[model samples]
Structure formats: C-alpha cells, structure tokens
Target chain A: TQLLEQSPQFLSIQEGENLTVYCNSSSVFSSLQWYRQEPGEGPVLLVTVVTGGEVKKLKRLTFQFGDARKDSSLHITAAQTGDTGLYLCAGADSNYQLIWGAGTKLIIKP
Target chain B: GAGVSQSPSNKVTEKGKDVELRCDPISGHTALYWYRQSLGQGLEFLIYFQGNSAPDKSGLPSDRFSAERTGGSVSTLTIQRTQQEDSAVYLCASSLFFMQGILSVGELFFGEGSRLTVL
Candidate 1:
C-alpha cells in the first residue's frame, strides 16, 4: 500500500509564528494537494501541485511539491489564529486515487 | 446542490447495529469519493466512484463495509456489525473528473461529514 507519512503530528505556536509541515512517501505521485480542515468540518482544498519542484502560494500559506514528487510541504508565514486546523497532504497515485497522509494538527494561539 | 451534502451529520449506534451514511454530490460532478477520518488523523480512503465505470473498493477495510452509488449521483455507504473501531467521521467528496485528461487537477469539494459513534 502506498503511504503518505506526515511529520509533526501536532504543533502549538503563538500567533505570528511561522511553521512548516511535511509529507513524505516512497512512491511517486502524479500530483499532490494540501487541505485544511476545521473542527467538525471536512477538509478544504488549499492548493494542488502537479509538477516536481513546484511551489504555490495562497495568502500567507506556501506549498511546495518535492522534486521527486514523493513529498510535499506547507509553510505558514506569520500564522494567525484562523490558521488553527488540521493540515492534510494527499498524493494522486498512478491510478489517480488519492493517498492521504495522517495530517498535522496546528494550533495557533492568539 | 452548490456543494457536497451528507446526511445524518451525527450518528450513535450500538456496537452490533448497522448504520447507513449518505452523500449527495454536487450536480454534474462525475466523480465521488468516500473517506473515514479518526480523531486527529488523516482521511482514509474507503471507496470511489467515477462516471459509469466500476467503483473502486480496494480501500475498504472489510467485507462488512459496502457502498453504492445510484444514477451516478447520490451514494450510500453501509456498515454492518459496527464496532468501536468503526467510530469516526465519514467524509464525502466530489470532483468534476479525474485529472488525467484535464489540464489541471480538479479540486474536491467535501461535505461537512457524518460523525459516527459506536458504543
């Protein structure tokens, strides 16, 4: 089974602090996506990176797809309280099925 | 619908009982997916449906888990003999289509999810 492993399962930081979360896997993917989920709600898509070494930015969040397509990262610059949520990375396998990482729970305390 | 919708936002059932979760994808969406998320965990793919092709059941954990999509729109996932391990948030998502032939990857719109608890 293809597995997407995420690092730093939990993070608690003060508002304005920057943090980075990672997702890694041994298998290559056609694309990778980042999602943020608030409590009691399903995940909302943040961005999708299809090319190796690609980077996409959305407001204060920056997402990077690894050169090998086997990993990805999400960096939050000056995180705000609204950034508190679960961040998930999903890779599109060769079959077009999504392989999801366990996710990182980020708490940005104001 | 403007977005994916799931019914029975929360459910509590006995350990041996059965439960059914429903999903209504956005109109015209050709792809649908089912996933389970434990507390503080990522989504676990359960099943997938695309256009009229056969559904993907590879991610289902056991035979007791079954899902069906009717008329290529709404879907229902049924769990039999529920166990505590089955307690989790069941999420449904839909996309326009798979990204293979498309120029860009499609975004998946997810429902609020149905939270299931087995006791």
Candidate 2:
C-alpha cells in the first residue's frame, strides 16, 4: 500500500505566526492535492500540484510539490484563526486512486 | 445537487445491526468514490465507480463491507454486522472523470459526509 507520511501531527500557534506542514512518501505521484477540513464537514480542496517543483499559492496558503514528486508541503503565512483546521495531502496513485496522509491538525490562536 | 450529497449526516446504531449510507454525486460527474475516516486519521479509500465500468472493491476492508452504484448516479455503501471499528465518518466524493493520462488529475468534490457511530 502506498503511504503518505505527514509531519507534525498537531500544531498550535498564535495569530500571525507561520507554519508549515509536510507530507512525504517513497512512491512517486502524478499529482498531489492539499485540502482543509472543518468540523462536521468533508475536506475542501485547497490546491493541486501536478509537476515536480511546482508551487501554487491560494490567498494565505502556499503549496509546494517536491522536485521528486514524492513529497509536498503546505505553508501558511501570517496565519489567522480562520486558518485552523485539519490539513490533508493526497496523491494520485497509478490506479487513479488517491492515497491520503493522516493530516495535520492546526490551531491558530487569536 | 450542485455538490455531492450524503444522507443521514449522523447515525447511531447497535453493534450487530446493519447500516447503509447513501451518496448522491454532483450532476454529470462520472467518477464516484467512497472513503472512511476514523478520528484523527486520514481518509481510507473504500470503493470507486467510474462510468459503467467494473467498480473497484479493492479498498473494502472486508466482505462485511460492500457498495454499489446504480444507474451511474447514486451509490450506497452497506456495512453488515457493524463493529465498533466501523464507527467513523463515511465520505463520498465525485469527480468529472478519472485521471486519464500521466499529467491529468481530477479534482474531487466531496459531500458533508455521514458520521456513523456503532455502540
């Protein structure tokens, strides 16, 4: 089974702090996606990166796909309380299935 | 619906009982997927349906778990003799289509999910 290991399973920071969450795997992926989920809701896609060394920024969140396509990272700049949630990373396997990471729970204190 | 829809947002059932979760994908989406999420864990793929092709059941944990998508629109996931381990959020998602080539990636639209609690 393909596994995506995410780092810093739990994170807590004050407002305006910056945080980064990383997802690593031994298997290379064709594409990687980042999602943020709130309580009582399914995850919402934040961004998708397809190429190696790709970077996409959405508002305060920036996502980077590793040069080897075996890892990805999400960086939040000037984090706000609204940025608090579970951040997940998913990669597309050869079978077109999404292999997901355990995710990082982020709490931004206001 | 504009987005994927799941029924019985929350369900509390006995350990030996059976439960069925429903998923209604967005109109015109051809790819549907089922996943289970335990507390503090990532999404675990359960089943996948694409168009009229054979459904992928490889991810189903056991024979007790089965799912079916009818007429290419709505799908149902059934768990028989539910166990405490089956308690989790059942999520359904749909994409316009499955990834076709090396570079194409389908973006999945997810529902609010059905939270099942087995006692």
Candidate 3:
C-alpha cells in the first residue's frame, strides 16, 4: 500500500477555475512538502507545512496541513495556464526518508 | 546558487549491460538521496548518504543496484545487469545536514534527473 495517497490522479480545468488536491495517510509525519514539476525538468519545492494545522500561501496557491499531521491539501485560485504541471506531495518519515505520493497531473487549459 | 546536477541526461543500454549514473549535489549540502521514477509511476526511494556515515540502502530494489558517495559530495548509482524493467528516470536530491529530518522540513533541491532506457 502507498504510504501517501493522492486524490484526483489527473485534473483538467479551464483557466480561472479553482481546484483542490489532497494527500492523505494514516501515519503522522514530521513535515509535509509540495512540489511542482514541468515536463523535462525536476520538481521544485512549492511549500512546506511543518506544524499541525499550519497553512501556507504562495501567491495563487494555498497549502494546509491536517490537524493530525496525517493529511494535507493544495488549493489553487484563479488558476492560469502556467499553473499546469505535476503536483507531488511528500512526507518525511521517522527514518528521515521521504515517502512520495503518485502525484497529480494538473492541466489548466486556456 | 547552483542546484543539483546529474550527468549523461539520457542513456540507452542493452539488457544485461551495466550502467552508472552520477549526481553532483549542491555545494555545502551533506545529505543526498537517489530515487527512480518509472513512466506513470510515483518516485521510489533508492538510497541516501549523509556525511561520512554509512548510507541507507534499504530502498534499493535488488542486489544488482548499488550506490556510493565519495568525499561526501558526488555520488554514483550503478545498476548491474540492467533489465528492461529498469528503464526510468533517476533523480538526485540534496539538502543540508541539519535538514536531514528537522530544520529545513524536507525541502529537497533536485537535479534534472537522468533518463535511462534499457533495450
């Protein structure tokens, strides 16, 4: 079983639409991170939520960590075509190794 | 600052051949990790190196896979007797020592990944 499960393996929406992606797990994590990857490039860190119930905003994107530290969410508002990419969530296990989700491919078409 | 970098962006090798992929982590970073991403699949952890200590090789998929970090800077991941199933993009990441499992909160600086195809 995947330690981290991501919902909506794929997403397609028109420009300006808003959406949310989820990452869930029954295990608690020390911290959770979100990344965005474009074709032909490596993933880049978008945000990191450390504390339980913590929320972070990066311009048009918002990230929230579950109060129990077992889940997280990524929301985009007024999405633009540039927002299209693969969104990945990862958690740091107690061993310091990162457990990754399968990633959600988000396509914002104009 | 320069981010992580890998060599031979793309490679194609015959099945049963051996292949070595290299990674150059960011300067001053003491933690390095290797992972593989097969087509349409999630990233799978392979190995990790921290300072002069022994590496964590628990994630290696088989006995044919091995990795070593020299001088705590550059690392090489070797897959012996490569098989078709080994075709995938290999990614490398680096972070500061203190960021191992704490302060930096798992913020990884990733290289542009090496794509290997076993024919």
Top DockQ model: 2
- DockQ scores for all the models shown? 0.73, 0.75, 0.67
| Predicted candidate 1 versus true structure: per-residue lDDT over B8-92, tens digit per residue | 9999999999999999999999999999998888898899999899999998999999999999999999999999999999999
> Where's the lowest-lDDT run of ten residues in candidate 3 chain B?
B97-106
Each prediction's TM-score versus the true structure: 0.95, 0.96, 0.95
Instruction: State the lDDT at A18 in candidate 1.
Output: 95
* Candidate 1 residue pairs in clash (backbone atoms < 3 Å): none
For model 1, the superposed segments whose C-alpha errors exceed 4 Å read B98-105
DockQ for model 3?
0.67
What would the per-residue lDDT of candidate 3 be over residues A1-110, giving only the tens digit for each residue? Answer: 33999989999999999999999999988889999988878889999888999999999999999999999999999999999999999997776568899999999999
Please name the candidate that would achieve the greatest lDDT relative to the true structure. 1
Local error of candidate 1 at residue B77 (angstroms): 0.5
User: Which residue segments of model 3 deviate by more than 4 Å?
Assistant: B99-104
Among all windows of ten consecutive residues in candidate 2 chain A, which has the lowest summed lDDT?
Answer: A92-101
Each model's lDDT: 0.93, 0.92, 0.91
